[model samples]
Target: MALKSPRFASNAALQNAARSAPPIRRGANGQHVAAIQQAFIDLGLGMAISTKKAGKADGIFGGETESRVWQFQARMGLTRDGIVGRDTMAKLDELLPTAGPPPKPLPPAKMTHKINVHMRSIDNPTVPEFTQLKVMEEIYAQYLIRVDVLTGQSVGLTPGEQFTLNIVDGDCKWDQVSDEQRLLQNSGSNQGVGVNDIVVYFATVLREKNGETLQGCAGHAPTRPAVMIAASATDKTTMAHEVCHVLLSSSFTPVHVGEDANLMCSAPMCTGQPAYLSVAQLNRVFASKLLHKL
Candidate 1:
């Protein structure tokens, strides 16, 4: 069914109803969603703020809206849990303007890249190809980029080819493996990809620099644009996090200390939370070589 447009009964009635309503969550729909969407816009965050794209405030608490909620929570130093509970709503009420010139919208980036993502796996046969593609779509939507995700046949995990990675303390380091072995593992499982494409490899496990188990890896290659996501992490945000790395490259630091909620923050404090890209990181992605904005 089509989500109805926001219909406020009256300014006073709307405020009272929203102020007294229960917490809002994913899949919520109705006037409350509309009021919250308007609140985000009033705060200068824009519509579909998490995606940073123009979209209707169509009174449905879908993924994009959920993300924006968490982003708002993060910025406000609230719980960052993505739930629009009473506390969050109260904060929103306090911050939203009573009346004034509407906050200025962020200017659109001049360039937007149209890119492709190729999926590959090694020693991990059952890659979450569809789920990962959905992640890429949602993430690119944030930057207003068009993405084409291409799935490749699964490879490796053969009886003799399965190699156990070295683990240091609690981390698993794939880089500890010989360069030749890493090259062979990546190359042998490869599928043809496009010039403006990134190869996403699903691995059984990923390790930190010291060989501690990490969630994923993202870096540039002479012949390929690549990011590796550990099938084990299981957090929905991990894939998008690594992809942000591939797009932002070394120009930006891997982590932002004060901005733990930003997509690029690798701090332990930010662990376990969904991450959103900072405006600067969004601009860097637009300027990156990996994307030939079309």
Candidate 2:
């Protein structure tokens, strides 16, 4: 016959029992299991138990609770048995907070859109130092943007797949190139870009008419959109700048307001190195369909 759990008079009694409690094997049920489960949750090892199924620390030492205890044992470098014996209970007692319960986490805001990026490299087919994680970090640091990579691969660019640069002298030809031309020219082996997603290609070289090198450039295609960043533009802020252009462009017109120390303003025009978007620019980004707001 299965053994029934021993009941306690109160929580103080349960906690006191937990300090010197005996082995809590499967099939046992009582306030002891509830106390142990709550202790597990408070210690930041919550994945062990299915809270939804267990429901407010049900006083049952069943398979689920046993499994949770086993996980806790494994994490604590103890025996992996599915039993909470004297040693396990002692460890739990040692780790349990002496103060109040753990603070509840705030619910994350709903993500409006997920920007799927296709990272392509030139000749050697090498992914840049600026990875998807770094990209997410940069964009999310400033704007409330939700971006992710399509697949976890540094796709190789064939001989033909190169960023098309406009030949201009004494100035950056970033705006001279159209989004349509940029997409069509670099549309090599890019069969995974979704309708709402964008492609970011890292090219070998991007020079002007007089061989003047540019840091990076980007354009937006309302019909077919993509952003081509120079591999030389290694900084995260540069990537953020180009991406901002793609998502927050106003009717293909220059939204970059010069004379301000912001991300939109570049060198010579602005008094700083890396800049940021203005309040108006932020409003534009927040209003865009690409971003999900709180």
Which prediction has the highest TM-score against the true structure? 1
User: Distance (Å) between predicted and true CA of 17, model 2?
Assistant: 56
C-alpha lDDT of residue 240 in model 1: 70
Tens digits of lDDT, candidate 1, 43-72: 665553333343656777664566667657
Tens-place lDDT per residue, model 2, 1-294, is: 111122222344344444544567777777767777776666654433335555667767654556456556645666756676656765654554343553442223334345566665442213353553474454444233466767434544343433332221233333345443454335463677666665665555555556766555564346445555555554445555666776675454455655344556555233222233444455566555655343
Please, what's the RMSD in Å of model 1? 11.9
Model 2 / residue 178 / CA error / Å: 7.5
Against the hidden reference, what TM-scores do the models get? 0.55, 0.47
Q: Which stretches of candidate 2 lie over 4 Å from their true place?
A: 1-113, 123-127, 131-136, 152-185, 220-222, 250-254, 257-261, 268-276, 292-294
Question: In terms of TM-score, how similar is model 2 to the real structure?
Answer: 0.47
In Å, residue 25's CA in model 2 sits off its true spot by: 63
What lDDT score belongs to each candidate, Candidate 1 first? 0.57, 0.51
Among all candidates shown, the one with the greatest lDDT: 1
